[model samples]
Target: MPKDTMTAEQRLQTVIRLGVPDRVPVDPMIYYFAAYYANITVHELWSDMKKYEFAINKCFNELGPWDIYYPINPISPEAYMFILPMKMKLAGLDLPPDEINQVIEEEIMSADEYLTFARSKTPTTFLKYINFLSTLACRVQREQQGEGIFAKTRIIRKMLKQIPVWREEFKRWQARDVAVQHGICMEAPFDTLSMSRGLVSFSYDLMDNPGPLAEVSLALSKGYVKVGDWLTKKTGVRRVLVFCHRTSNDFVSPKQFEQHAFPSLKAIVNGFVERGVTPFLHCDGNWNKNLEYLYELPKGKVVLQFDGRTDIFRAKEIIGGHCCIFGDVPASMLAFGGKEEVTEYCKKLIEKAGKGGGFILAAGCEVAPNARPENVKAMLDSVKKFGYYS
Candidate 1:
């Protein structure tokens, strides 16, 4: 095979532009798993990030040398940074730090709040809820951390102090010639609604009160663009990470997806593309029936990343040239399968989804906290063995 002829960013951008690069880039989304793979608890990763960085580098040098650096978030992810923030059973707070956290799936918005939300012309109504929730969060923090008046103040102070950790992560990765994977994070409005109203209630709302839900979703997508744009300017990274799972074909019927999900999602995606920023969608569910719908997006401007739930092979058939595809390696395989089992699956992925261009090899969603190191190494090494292009 020929030696690499492009830089890491060049290779990634090549796929983004719908062109073949020297090789396929591997971009595993190693979130809490990073802490797990290193035998460090998730909470420890957030609390002592320099330690996190060292362990991550060790993973790369020993088992990885993977393309794209997944940044150790400087800000604690447990905090309220979501576009449509809602209560969650956060790790290290409501649950064990290392255990998978829950979304609570409880209702925050009542049935009556929908009309008022849609009718209001300004963001004041939205901000009012956010302010109320934020204050509630402060008390939650104070109660969880301590009982003193200055307890909340002390905890808030510590959260702000982690910004340097992210800077260090970025600097270290850039210095090492690895591409950093981070940007302004946002979510699809419909998904937010599902979580806020609870899925069962939201499904009823979809049936009986579709109009307001649609209107609220549209407004939230627009709001996301505004917030994402401002953050992009501040961060100087021209990428937007949009998390969309509730709209997938497996979650809702095709007709419902097109009606309630696709429109608002397309609006948010195109909104970012229009502003010259790339929207990297973190698709969290099966999207088989919705693959054709993705072609409605601007050609070569957006990335449709899949978890294991999506059929990546058929996806390559549908949107190969129209958009870049990332991921589909099952986390189960990484955490349980033998090295040979993992390697065979990866080779299959390379031969099929990677035959042309516009493919990124990554764990379907994220590397599991209990993923076998040998299996991860096998996944990482497959690219070097079979990923190169002539």
Candidate 2:
């Protein structure tokens, strides 16, 4: 739009391609805050498709100038029954409009069940859907009381009607030249296990029953590739965000991670790469111990994004010029730090990570609900002031 060397989309693509762009792209992970700013309850945003689109567009109008636009959560109606099985105040129909949707993390499968899944010839989708429905039923029972049946039917109807609407919304965003729509999001196998089996249970499984856990991890990795392929075909986007949370150093020792996490992660990355999609690794938490393993994956085909927990500067030194590195601005700073504090910190981040061409400026994680709008403004402003390649 400004007649720069690259369009906003091109600017982001340049960094993703491991080349320096005319300026560093400003991309932040945004979620609940969108509804917060739009003056709508999270329930309305996720339950009603039309309102969801309106609120997201409102967020774009109000907070943007961003290179990449990520429509975080309440992805689609089918997503409710399939990809996300969590039930909370806003997500489940019986709850109040003000209640927030939350991911229900419980070990739905026993240790032997994991082994059974690994050995079964059944389609992973069938298994996952069955498990999701079971979990949803359980949630409905607990939260819906007598209204469960009616509420569930209403929610499903709403979702079914919105499928086409959501597709059209994505098409409209894709037509916009100023911003790139983020593609499909997938999680690494280990993280999937952590979510399916509560962290405590998964931790125990890892230590007490490593064999079944490893088998299940491999099975999940294979399933993810199939899922990624399906999503790529469905959405026509070739980028996948492979979220890896529990695999971080905060949760496991180096040996445990190498044994259980790295193999499946490698498989998933390779599987996606083989299918002609770029994998963007959202490796949250302290991954200092596993930084070296990232190098083992194919170069220039992956973008590594870190939450504030990881030492991104060290990451820059380890993989900086070779791979595109996305963030580390503490969410806490964005939430409580003054404008000047935010500005200075951003400047330093740019000077260090933006020195080469492959860094994108962003908060370590999602800009929290309490994050000051002025601080966010400061973040965008700092990029304009210091992120230029000249």
| Candidate 1 similarity to native, TM-score | 0.88
Q: Give the per-residue lDDT of model 2 (tens digit) for 113-193.
A: 676656666556535423333434444333443324565565555444544554556567767754543456655767766
lDDT string for model 1 (1-390, tens) is: 567788888888888887889988898777777777777766666556566776687788888888787653544543443343455565576678776655566676687866565555554644533333333344334245433446545544554454444445566676777776655566677887776677889889888877776776776666567666756665555777787858887678888888888888989889889988888898888898988998899999888889899889999998887999898789899888999999999999988898888888889878887888898899988888888988
The Cα local distance difference test for each model comes to 0.74, 0.71
Q: Report lDDT (Cα) of residue 283, candidate 1.
A: 88
Q: What is the TM-score of each candidate against the true structure?
A: 0.88, 0.86
Task: Give the least accurate 10-residue stretch of model 2, judged by summed lDDT.
Answer: 81-90
How high a TM-score does candidate 2 get? 0.86
Find the 10 residues in a row with the least total lDDT in model 1: 128-137
Task: Please list the residue runs of candidate 2 whose C-alpha ends up more than 4 Å from where it truly belongs after superposition.
Answer: 1-3, 75-81, 84-96, 123-166
| Candidate 1 ranges beyond 4 A from true positions | 72-74, 77-84, 121-168
